[model samples]
Target: GRALGEDYEVRAAATAEEGLAAVEADPEAVDLVLLDIRMPGRDGFWLLDRLREGFPNLPVVMVTAYGDTETAIEAMKRGAYDYLVKPFDVAHVRALIEAARKQRALTRSAVSLEPDAPSPGDRIIGNSPAMVEVYKRIGQIAATTLPCLITGETGTGKELVARALVQYGPRAEKPFLVVDCAAIPKDLLESELFGYEEGAFTGARKGGKLGKFELAHGGTLFLDEIAEIPLALQSKLLRVLQDGTFQRVGGTEEIRADVRVIAATCADLEARVAAGAFRADLFYRINVGRIHLPPLRERRGDIPALVRYFVQKHGAAVGRPVTGVSEDLLRALQARPWPGNVRELENEIRRLLASTRGEVLAAEIPPACPGEDAACGELRSLAARALEEGGEGAFHRFVARAEASLIAEALERTGGNVSAAARLLGITRLTLRKKAEEYGIRVPDPDA
Candidate 1:
């Protein structure tokens, strides 16, 4: 109390009832609460439910004893701002408080889909016909608890679509959790989704932990890169989807959670299932409602609006607000084949915002290599010629010639500057130099 009292007002309550009384007497008296999980009379969770129901905006941080981290995690799932294990230092508490305050403010704001709204909310900005279909699909399903599968190439804003689904849904006020299947290690993925019991495994936290399904009760859980989940764990996921019941990693008691599952992936699940890499049953279960987002290249008409939206969004964040982008820049942007989709385009715009000095952005957009169709056609022609002339090693010879040609072209365009050339080619300077040397392509001095 002494440590925090020096920095904060520091209200004190001995028991859960007292804490409730403290808040009930005057809710405005407290901005945050530090509640312990093992309190007398009414437990922290019971009180937490009251706080969340009575004052949904109030941020609460769970204070748990050492070895009770899992319970703390469960409290977090129940809308606690954060948790702190006993024996934490003063610095940790302060840092958590600051973070929680910032996040609380951020979460309360609504997300907007308005194309040209002045507010800092329109995270999704597009009016293309394809995108209109996406919006329509979201509107149709967002109000239900149907399990949804979002499919799109990477950076096509799958997560944003998932967020839109949540924001427009009946569970808008509930917790929304995200798990990136590709990002987490395969061995750890199961535990992350379902959590584990204390002593479930060596080095596991003391108290049994609640998984996403349990934590996200009455909310939404988004699984990104859904195809990456291991084949072994697919059944457990399917069980939850079918019955809304799953057990913790080391515990046997079945836990049921009212969580809506929304999954996203860039990979083809049908192909994965055919290859025995994914479960067909699970695939069908989650694919009940599907939304496919088109790649940025396919939605070229939306490029100008996206560009303007990104400029405004990033400019304000970086304190380099621009008046507008030039028509020539928009034309150039629309012409490029953004292999990385919306994310890549936003990055290009951010780069321009950083480099441009004028209020109106008129910087020359770098020329793109080629549209997908044209590039594929060019490759087909090259391969046919190679097959006819190069005979036995046609594939290898064609690849070598293509690499050498691209490297030589990039070097020439960049005036033999290896780093600049490498950036243009989307490769490391060292790799470019090695390839250039192997191909006997002339490059100026490394420094020059």
Candidate 2:
């Protein structure tokens, strides 16, 4: 009410089931939700899953403690619009609410006309600031025929973004051609891009095949590994960009080039130019609109969403039904450095889906284990969040989660030796066994 006064009236729900039922009864009545992560019986994360089921596009912001980055990321991965930390600033809250409201309105507008109206590019899953910036750029350049240069590390989704720009724009109905500059030999790169006349060379086709540029006329052409274009061919590409005209190899006629160009490079073009490998002039031409995709490590927050996406995509391929991933596997995934970026993460998820028959991915052993301090980190974060939301109010669930994690870790470290694990915990064997049972800790077989 403070933000929009009469226009916005908040209807509060004290519990998860209450909120779920209210939304289920009349989801249209609520424009947004501010859900606390540490509710009794069911936490904010639980409600997020339920809400997504009933209203996939409804904006639900997880209200977390100030430093619960893990929870915030998990919430977003579960399809929350954004998250708000405790001690919320009125201005920031208002801004998030307004943004979510607008986005929800837009989605509803589009979905009303066509139930499956989401464009391929709009489905680029991520909530990290870096991926958010990438999405913004995709929206900014989607409508125009601008020369866009996308720079990123290999497998960082440069080609995906280029396709999104075309998929979500006015040119979506037109042809989209892709040329891998590094894949083709330097000798054939020119002929491959601008085509050639019949009998232009010893092995030329009798009827002459059209180049990527001609085939992509009036649409968009993606040049992958753009920095690999040989110096001799750079001038020809520049001519096409400058005057929208290019001649077929060994032909006198100049063809009108009505294609929009999007170039991607994992290499450093400026450095390539300095080393006299890439043309500085051509670099500037394609740099009209630029997008730099961040490596996966920089945007680890997106791992959950990417995992969810890949699970949904590849699960049905092998006829498996995957509901979601386990917290252990998800945490382990986030711990990885992902040197190969999104591509590596995608492949890993695909592998898990193919290997596992269960609904949860944690059934498959994690690729990496999180640090020993992972529980401590979570404990401190939850404590701080609890204090901010309710001073001196002890959150038993937080303590329980920390205990469960510790017990599980100890059992794993002890090789299922009850006496050894009890000694390591400084507790009696019976207490250790009971705690392990309570936390559902499985002691792996030492021999097996």
Kindly report which residue stretches of model 2 are placed more than 4 angstroms away from their true locations once superposed. Answer: 1-122, 363-448
lDDT of each: 0.77, 0.73
Candidate 1's residue-wise lDDT over 1-36, tens digit each?
899888888888989989989999987557678888
Over 1-448, each residue of candidate 2 has an lDDT whose tens digit, in order, gives: 4555555788778899998988888877888888888888898888998887767667788887755667767877887777777777887777666656655544443233221233332345666657655654665567578899999876688888888778666788999999977556678999999999999999999988789899998899999988667677898999999999999998999799799999998766775564344678999999999999988878898788777767766666768567778998888889876656777688788778778877777755454335534344335444543343343425754465456545555655665577877788788877876765554344434357
TM-score for each model? 0.58, 0.58
lDDT of 1 at 268: 70
Alpha-carbon shift of residue 361 in model 1 (angstroms): 0.9
**How many clashes does the backbone of model 1 have?**
0
Q: In model 1, what is the error at residue 242, expressed in angstroms?
A: 0.7
